[model samples]
Target: MGNVKKKKIALGLQLLIALFLGGAAGFFLPQFASFYQFLGQAFIRLISMLIIPLVLPLVVVAVAEVLGKNHFQKLLGKTFLYFFAVTTGITALFVFASYYLGFGQGVNIGQEGASLEGIATGVKIDEFFLNFIPSNLFKALTDGALLPILIFAIFLGYGVGQLEQEKKEAFLSGTKIWIAAIYKILDAVILLSPVGVFGFIAKDVATTGVDKLLGLGQFVLGMYLGYGVLALVIFPVIAILYKVNYVKLFKSIGDLVTLAFVSGGSSVVLPPLLKRLKKEGYDEAVTDFVVPLGYSFNLEGAAVYFALATVFLANAYGITFTPQALLFTVLLLSLIGKTAATIPSGAIVVLLAAAPQLGLPVEGVALILSVDFFANAGRTALNVVGQALAVAVLDSKKEKTEKVEKPAKAENVTGKELIANAG
Candidate 1:
């Protein structure tokens, strides 16, 4: 354990150094941005290649094991309830904050050529619902459609749980073997993250440039401010409530957090995050269940970005929202935030899909896109932290509940033994 911790600290320092070096390279040697971009993108692709294979069997085995336990419903309910409440609360707060603070005020939409070419604008209610159920599971896996894969995994896991005990155990054992193998591969991929982070940060800084970021300074600052409060203030408070050592927890996962921030992709950190949470003594079942599900549902960081970005765009378009309109926007964003994990550039895609409905100009999204990377870095880091914290808190609660139950079980056993002795 001591060795592992030392290694993590070493890796964390390496990532920070890489981030600095990358930023300098991007700023001073923009000529090599394309090369940096290639390195960064290749790293992401390597991680992405393993996501479906890792998440599918992992979720299946987790859900199956949880269902085989007595506390399945209670655990599942608590997890989703936590996710929904936290995400919705963050979304609402940021929506109101961005509006009142005039985050997008005086911003001009000069990036007219910024096209929403690939992203589909305007929500299709039927299509959105249909997406949750993939017509072809293989197609969904190929396309990396996470929602469908998750849905399929859950049902498959539940079905496996209903099988004869021996069969179920055999199936689970096989899947566990598969998941373990994937982790081995994933760990190898993660060791290259310093190189990846350097390239990713370099490419982003070089391509986005400081002037464009400065122009959208208010929006970027507001987004980071939201991320800061969530990570530094709100999450610490949650850690306290759950009796988790906030400082120690973050310290242990500092390397993964840095990677998430620099890479701007939370999925890349999932493997290490899970391993670290388990090492922290969070229940294996709960950590496995909550963290993956949290990726899909409990995106507190994306909630902040989406809510703030919506208001910022609205403000840029000089669109005013009444109480009813603001309420509606908050609700819509809270729902959209759930889908953020399923798509690439998810928050951006959902924002595009939602802009038309909110009466915000689609072109405004293009303007926000210019500085999205800066905001994305912060949000992705916050997302990773939030997921870990959720696991810690939920595990704490589970432990307390078990502690209360064990005494009752002891009493019952003692009473039975006394009666048997008396007889």
Candidate 2:
């Protein structure tokens, strides 16, 4: 126990130190851009390698296993709706607030290195159902088409759920081993994360000097402002309302939160998250179902960033939207982009997808990419917090229901015994 605590303390410090060193290197040693970029890309690739084997199987297995239990379907329904509602509502609010604050007004749109010729058509409302079915599963996964991959996982999970009891058990057991083995490998990879964080931040700083960040200060400030409100105010209120002790909850999950912020990959922090949830007295069944699903489906952080970036870019390009148009643009893009877990640079991919359709200068993507490291720290941390809060809320409701049921049964038994004694 003592050794574990020491390691946890050391890990957090190491990441923080690495971030500081990396930023310093970038500010002071711009000539080493190539080396730091290589290091950053390698680290990102290391995390990306875990996506297919980890994400698809984890989703399928968790869904399949939970489907066999009582009341889980209802739990699953509530979980899905909760994530969707919170993500959509909060994201819309940020976009509107950022717009009203004039985040991107009077910015000159850079044309150099900006090519908008091949922007894929945005998702149409009528075609939404058909868009989920990829022409080729392998290609979709390779292309990082997140919605297609999730759709595939959902189908495969349903198939597994239909298996005979013994067969289903055997299959899930095998999956458990596969996931565990991958997590063990991931544990090894995590040791190199400080180095990865250093490389990633250094490269960003090297490529875009501090002055460029200052030029975009309004947008960055707005982004962080949104994060500050969500983390400090909104999430805590939700926890308090649900009867979860907010202080204790954050204290318990501090390590996972640090991992989320530093690594900027919420998927990579699942092992620690699950362990923490279990230790904090969440049911194994609830954590098992919610955590992985949260990774794939519950990216509140990414949703907020998407909304802010979209509106900011629109403002920069001097594009004005009617209220209805703004509603259409923000909701469609933000919600669609939230369909799956993001890779390290996934926000750029999402920006590219939504920008062209909204008449936002595609080049505006570069602005956000420059400050992605800082943005990602806050965004991914929120993802972890959102997941934990979802579980706590549901578990609290479950406990209350049990309490009500237990006393009623006991009272009925006591009443029946008294009547029999009187007779």
Candidate 3:
């Protein structure tokens, strides 16, 4: 554990150094931004390649195993409901906030002729629902359509759950093996993140110069503001309802929070977070189940950023969203945000994937990519807090349920004493 922590710290320092070096290169040597651009983009593509393989099997196995066990059914249902409600609610709130508060109003980073007008007029409510049901599964897989793939995986997992035990176990074992292999590949990809971060920052700084920094600053401030609301307001309300001491809860996990903030990734903090929860007397079963699931599904921080960034970029490009368009955008972000756990900086990859579909320019994504490290710090810290809170709440609920169902013990009496009394 000590060695792991040391290594993580070492990597964090490496990334920080890379970020500084990249920015300096971009500012002083704008002519070579193209090289940095290639490095960054290649890293993104490698991460993208692992997403489907990683997400599909992992989701399938998770759903299958959870559904197969009757004991876990209720826990699974509650966890999923909590994750969905919190993520979607936070996403919608930020979507409205970003639009009303004018998050990206004055920051135009050369992305002209891009508009959400077509989306406003063309996206029918029914069509949006239909998009999740792919007519051809093969085509959906080939096209890397996340929504359709996710819907299909859920159904497939459920089907597997209903199978005979032997068959189900066989299938699950096979899928888990595949998932393990993919995770190994994912780890390799993540080791290259510093290089990717450097390239992205250098390229953007060189191409747009310092003029774009103002817009980047605005976006970062907006993100931190949203994170503040979640940390200060939304999560406190949740903790209160669960009978948890919100302040104390955070204090207990402070080390993990710091690690998450510095690392800008949740994967590294997960093991220690789980250990901390267990040490704090949270239900091990609940922590083990919900914390990991929350990483993939309940990324409140990423959800907020997704909604905010989408609207920010739209406004930056001089587009105004109608009510219907805003609603569609919120729904799209809520769904895509679930994919943020597939890799480090996975939010950017998912956003880039959804950009063309959202009618936002690809260049807009690149602009956001340059300063993601700054945004990710706050984002990942909130992610760590959110996951911990979810476990705490669920475990509290489980304790309450167990208490209610527990049978009271009879008063103790010796056999001789009972016989004498009866006589």
Candidate 4:
């Protein structure tokens, strides 16, 4: 009972403190809003810096571990199959929901709702496939080509797997230590989230007022609600079916989501999220690989946002959506967008690219840019939660397979338990 009360108090403190700091930023620095903007930008930059090195080591370490052990390829094949299926399923769910809920349906918001913008308008599938392979890795970097970065990460992980076992283990172990240290720094960064969340939220609300929210309100509302339902309802149901109850499951990771929200960047939230999933009965191996992989490839919020935003743009421009056209748009985004990696400007770039592909307007992004930062906080929170959930599903399937081979149970206990057990 005392512990429960303590948890409640701690949570309350976080919420109140975040609110206070956010509100205080507005009052204290009334004239210099740019300073607050820098504060948010700096926090996001730190998260961005941390994510790349974070992913490299995790991918390298995880690949070494998975490949050196038993039936690694089979496990990986099955995991990817499930991961892709789940990612697509989540994407499909939102696309359908957007259409069903009829959001941004009647609104006329974008100037060229029907323009192909700068795209070639129509391209052959084979040509697009050919484009996926980077013509120049250097050029891709300068050009912000996300698909190439992802292909590079996969190749690097696989190459790391070809090394000798002992050497690989040493490398993995060293990388693991560095990852742990990075996570510790992540925790310290998270400790600052409440202050950061408040600043961003309060400032966004103050400037936009409620009017902007009302203007593109349908799309904005859809983005948040879709994620909320998926994260709270759909994800929890998926967990329970996997034999993990959603209540404890969601509660287990609540702190991390809240932390991610405050931090305004999901990458900063990744380390703690991976840890929480393990504590909640997911495997470290699966979480390590899937979370990093999912961050790059499977973004639930971005997927939903893309759908709603396109619909909003199309509607705002008085462009009608044919059933066939909407289906094609959903299909392309699920395939291309899901494979895209996590980065600071990824969603923006993708959305800009998407406009021409879907025959929507590019200026739609400019119209939404101000709201992106605000909306993306919620996006990161949900996307990170979804990544953790995906790993939970993968972990469940593994548990099923292991049990079929032999009975299984919590094989060990450590941390505070080991100390108590030692005494």
* Candidate No. with top lDDT: 1
Tens digit of per-residue lDDT, candidate 1, span 285-358: 88888888889888888888898889988887788999789999988888766777633356788898788888
Per-residue alpha-carbon lDDT of candidate 3 for residues 1-71, written as tens digits (9 for 90 to 100): 55664325555566777778888999999999889989877876776677667667756765677676565
Clashing pairs in 3: none
Q: Which stretches in model 2 have alpha-carbon errors above 4 Å?
A: 1-9, 106-128, 134-146, 270-272, 316-318, 339-341, 356-359, 365-368, 395-423
Task: Report how far off residue 246 is in candidate 2 (Å).
Answer: 3.3
- What do the candidate models score in CA lDDT, each in turn? 0.83, 0.74, 0.74, 0.65
Q: For model 2, which pairs clash?
A: none
Q: Rank the models by TM-score, top first.
A: 1, 2, 4, 3
Q: State which candidate, 3 or 4, has the greater lDDT.
A: 3
Worst 10 residues of 2 by lDDT: 112-121
Q: What is the C-alpha lDDT profile of model 4 across 1-423, one tens digit per residue?
A: 556643344653685676667666676655556666666666666655666556656766666667766555776786667666666776666666566566666675544333334533334457667766777878866654545554565566677788887776677778889988888877677566555566665565446555555566666676788777767787777788777555666677787777666555677677667767766556666677788767756687777667776676676666666778877877877766653435433466566666777777677666776566656767777788778767766665656456433422345554565443332
TM-score of every model versus the real structure? 0.89, 0.80, 0.61, 0.78
- Comparing 1 with 3 on TM-score, the higher-scoring candidate is 1
31-116 in candidate 2: lDDT tens per residue? 99889988866866776677667767777876786677656578778888887777777778877778777877887545553344
| Backbone clashes in model 1 | 0
In TM-score terms, candidate 2 sits at: 0.80
Question: What's model 3's lDDT at 283?
Answer: 65
